[model samples]
Target: MPRRHDPERRQRIIDAAIRVVARAGIAGLSHRSVAAEADVPLGSTTYHFTTLDDLMVAALRQANEGFARVVAAHPALSDPESDLPGELARVLGAWLGGDRTGVELEYELYLAALRRPALRPVAAEWAEGVGALLAARTDPVTARALVAVLDGICLQVLLTDTPYDEAYAREVLTRLLPAPGTRDGRGPGSLPPPTAG
Candidate 1:
């Protein structure tokens, strides 16, 4: 069979960049290093991605798409009108309340994005998607808060040897957020009234 030009092999490099960033953060990314990890030719790296920005953009795209895929993977995660307190919590728990490699990978991906300007937009897009998901039942301010909380809780779990409790996370965030339709997702309005009582 003839080779497939415009092949997914390029995507493979991008995906590997995400993994490498997940494994080693931004410092670990390089055309040659990623090429080795992907087991493709180093020249293929230059052939597929000529600039660092292109590579970073590709990696960010991979990460953003991957997270969205995970969110879409669950039926409950997409439906904001559901019993959000319970469902949102479950989704948050599933996404971060475990010791899953994805959470760890996300940490690395985010950390790498911090120093890499080219990748910053990639991170922002992913954040916006997650924020939008949370905003479904709450306001934008809270949506941002929710992502922060999830990341914080994940960090806590990462630091500790103790077992994770998805239930607790669900309960806590449920109490913190307002009910669905209480507000129209911080759209065309000022921020949600000061959340802290």
Candidate 2:
């Protein structure tokens, strides 16, 4: 037999790994399972990923892009003068509203990082990426805080099966922003006390 030329084999395997995780979670992800899901020969998966961790890293990296794409589609998120909190809430709402499976799948793989050291960097990348996007409009501290709040909100909604309240999210996110004329939500905006006579 001759060798085959499948340029997309690697990507297919990654996609399959995501599907497998979505269906059976990280516990069910293996080269054999990914091969079956990808409809490729078992050897292909092994050739592309030397270990289960390698496959998981690839799948998680790809899954992290889902929310990034949603954020990218919303230009307001990057605009300094825009209602950043509202935009973030709207973007989150859009992400959570569309393709519930994808949102859940992304979180599942992301949360798996808690147990798998190999996945920690990939999970951090997601937060750093979003934080960077937000950093463009606010101080880095606030940007990071926004990411943390967003993560908490998402987990709460997913875990509790509660409907996403865009209004509440916006309010909370807005509170994270630095006060007007202040920097990093500190005392910069406060008027100094009158000097003693």
Candidate 2: worst-modelled 10 consecutive residues by lDDT: 188-197
TM-scores, each model vs. reference: 0.73, 0.87
Off by over 4 Å in 1: 1-6, 22-25, 78-81, 97-99, 160-162, 179-197
lDDT of 2 by residue, 130-178 (tens): 8888888888999999999999999999999988888778767777887
Q: What tens digits encode model 1's per-residue C-alpha lDDT throughout 24-105?
A: 7677788888999888878988888999678878766766665676677777755655655456556655666544666767
lDDT of 1: 0.69
TM-score of 1: 0.73
Output the lDDT of residue 19, model 2: 96
Model 2 stretches with alpha carbons more than 4 Å out: 1-3, 180-197
The lowest-lDDT stretch of 10 consecutive residues in candidate 1 is 188-197
